[model samples]
Target: MATFNVRPDIDAAAEKLGSTMGAKREIKRLPEVLWEGETVEMLATGSYGGGTGLVAMTSMRLVFLKHGVMSQTVEDFPYPKISSVQWQGGMLMGTLTVYTSGNRADIKNMPKDQGAALSDKLRALIAQGGQPAAAPAAAPAQDVGSRLATLDQLRATGAVSDAEYQERRARILDSL
Candidate 1:
């Protein structure tokens, strides 16, 4: 087993994974391994969503080991090799080397810093566990509405050309 510091933003990765996967996977501190480990047990499984509306799902059974790495085994679903695991602070970061080339929703378009940031934020939130702060006053909901109001004020003072205002207004509304 190998150990590494949890990145500061690993909470985000965990949160994202939890949200997408429908549950928070637990982690346990291993006495013998001296490392972090997720608390989920498993048989072999893999899922992939399509670019269209369909999703692919598959599963298989495997010989179980009482003390094997779930994270490493999961990465082997579409392939047949154990992935590497690293521990950061209170979180575990692991590589899904076999699935890296595809657009899996859980891993797609993920910002590298996001996971560490998420982990740090989650730790803070857990430490300060309490009701959320009361809502601040809501800003206007529509982006165009706010931009148009600002544009109106600017236009009243001839701050923008008619053509410029029209172009900007069109762009903002189109974004909606």
Candidate 2:
């Protein structure tokens, strides 16, 4: 068996999340993407597209990570960007879908119990306005400026609409 140097708190949290074989395998890799001080609240194992991965609900966001033999994929949905989460359950498995402004991600074949628990926890978090007890420290002014410049470039390239540029600009400013 492979071992990862996961923090004690994260290991304990994963223990509470579930004990399925998939969950156990995936949870070991979570420390790779988790930010400093980020707390894992829940974890579920499932398939997204053609990849089998784990979705971890943390204090700041939902992270989906897939580790393959030669490549890895990671996707993060910050609480502020998520509009809603939906769960559909059958006897043994379920699907959890997450919606953002213009994107949706469906994680299917999750164990029913894990999916339902994650859905309820996410709903409560959203209901509470997706604010964690302690907000992360503000970014440096240079970082903020860089983000603004990137947003401007996206607008200039027509990658993001004027409305999107404005919204993203305001979010970056608000973080300051």
Question: Cα-based RMSD of the predictions, in order?
Answer: 19.9, 11.0
lDDT by residue for model 2 (12-129), tens: 5666654446545456556546654566777778888688888888989999888775777899999988889999999999999999888999999998998999999888888888
Where model 1 places Cα greater than 4 Å from the true spot, the runs are 1-140
Error of 2 at 93 (Å): 0.4
lDDT of 1 by residue, 1-176 (tens): 21111221222223333232211111111111111111111211112221111011112111111222233112212212212212132233321112213422232222224334432432333344311223233244443464566556545645456987787678657756
Model 2: per-residue Cα lDDT at residue 169: 78
Q: How does candidate 2 fare on TM-score?
A: 0.69
Cα displacement (Å) at residue 58, model 1: 47
In candidate 2 the C-alpha lDDT for residue 102 amounts to: 86
In TM-score terms, candidate 1 sits at 0.22
Clash pairs of candidate 2? none
